[model samples]
Target: MAEKGRPRAFDRAAALRRAMVTFWELGYEGTKLTDLTAAMGINSASLYNTFGSKERLYREAVALYDRTAGSATNRALRGAPTARAAVEAMLRGNVDTFADPETPSGCMIVLSATNCSHQNRKVAEHLAEWRRTSVAELEKRLERAVEEGELEPGTDVAAIAAFYATILHGLSIEARDGVPLERLRSTVDHAVALWDSLVRQPAGRG
Candidate 1:
């Protein structure tokens, strides 16, 4: 057999972006090698050579998603004025990102490999860790809000963070199921209003 020719120098980052979108649209189990190769516009040998294996490729794709589509929530969390505003921004950002016409509808970490078999349990675990980190960050922000007199002193920061985290996960699922952006934005507004009602008052005030 003849030796294979030199592998073409296609754009690695561009290929990864394509892979990220593919994984976002189709869960790990739902995606196939052929689908990946086709989406990446690379042949099987090049795909294997560039990304090692399908599992590794999926992992890399998720990381890319974290830095790209999955980044809007983090940006909103950091950029908003108050803790409640931050949470609202995060949820609203999720709606815009998930509902964008350019990319897939759901979150890459949440919808990808969510319920795999034992052999692929590690993938699920990996995604779960990302969620745990996000929740922890939100809790830290909520706690800071309490310290800074933005939130009620008695507020349960952990519980509040957990509640919103759950809400974001549900929103991901709903967005994937074709929920309209306007409805999701309405939900975010309502959630933030709930937070506003529970906000801290000045000392000695009613």
Candidate 2:
């Protein structure tokens, strides 16, 4: 309970963001109440009053991470000049950011999906839904490319989308494993080359 004279002036959103990053780095099982409070700069009572419990706070944090990270990927997907370019750029951005030494925490969604227990089904389901949405968006982009003559009409859009999704998942693992940045870049370049091979040129025009 906070003192009557000293009001709780904490920024709730900012605190949740901090908590998101903390849990992202340490994981649910590893994160302690003290750790969260310290990172959030709020006392235990304030935290409980605001968020109810650690699990509830974690759920909020996960939602925040999903929105923030998903928006970034969505922006990259929409901003690319072409479908192939969009996929390449999105995957490259993910690899680069995840592998950056300055990125004190790796990907939150990936961490949760891989580490959280069966009891945390909601978290797992959220991550799976996000992945499905990503794949669907990629398929839409690929279909657009087909309509624009960028890919052959017969190209398998669903397969291409799945391939890119797999690449993104692999990059997340590599980042968690502390793979060297140079190696990750090389791998991304290879992935781009593979994706390029699938693009369909104008019919009868080489």
Candidate 3:
């Protein structure tokens, strides 16, 4: 073990990026220590020394994903001119990322840690919180769109957000199953088509 300023054998950030892709392609529990060490191009000792543990490394990898591959949806929600446009941009942007051959086929947060067993409950809960936060963010953006006169007053934004979130999650599964980019983009178009009627529906109408 070396002290601070002692150069490491491998690039830490680069290794983490590789870990993120591995977790994205294979769920958290499915990725073994050997898998990470191999992907990161580091040995077991380096992994444990640098990242503390596999769980800690996974958390960091997810954070990196949030800042990198997953940033586009947030940007769309903030940057688009209208609620419809924002939702469309968000979905389409994510679809493109999912379909990118250079990276894993699905979302890190959604596909990772799903269906964790009792012993892995905490891992499942962690991803659930991330998903709930994403839905909340969508609700907030839709509420803002209401204030901006983009969506009709009293629109049920919670339900709308949930609906779009489901579509977003489903698209990840589709991409993971090898759906073509063009077809996934078409799914986005089909999902956004409901925006008009959804906005017009009376609030709290179930």
Measured by lDDT, the strongest candidate is 3
**1-206, model 2: which lDDT tens digit per residue?**
87876757899999999998888778777788999999999999999999999888988987887677534567667899988778878877777667767654356766655656788777667667767887898889888988998888878787777777887878777778888878888888888898766554433332
Give candidate 2's whole-model lDDT. 0.78
Best-to-worst ranking by lDDT: 3, 1, 2
- Candidate 2 — which residues are off by over 4 angstroms? 1-7, 52-56, 66-72, 200-206
17, model 1: CA deviation in Å? Answer: 0.5
Best by TM-score: 3
Candidate 3 residue 46 C-alpha distance from true site, Å: 1.5
- Candidate 3, 73-147: lDDT as tens digits: 888888998878889999999999998989988899999899788988988898899999999999999999889
Global CA lDDT computed for model 1: 0.84
14 in model 3: Cα distance from truth in Å?
Answer: 0.3
Candidate 1 lDDT over 1-206, as tens digits, reads 54589777789999998988888888998888998889999998999999999889989998888887899778877787888888888888887887898888878888988889999999899999998999999888888888988877877777678778988998889899999998888887777777754444333342
Q: What TM-score, over all chains together, does every model reach?
A: 0.90, 0.84, 0.93
- Each model's C-alpha lDDT? 0.84, 0.78, 0.90
Among residues 3 or more apart in sequence or in different chains, the pairs in candidate 2 whose N, CA or C atoms overlap within 3 Å are none
- lDDT minimum window of 10 residues, candidate 2: 197-206
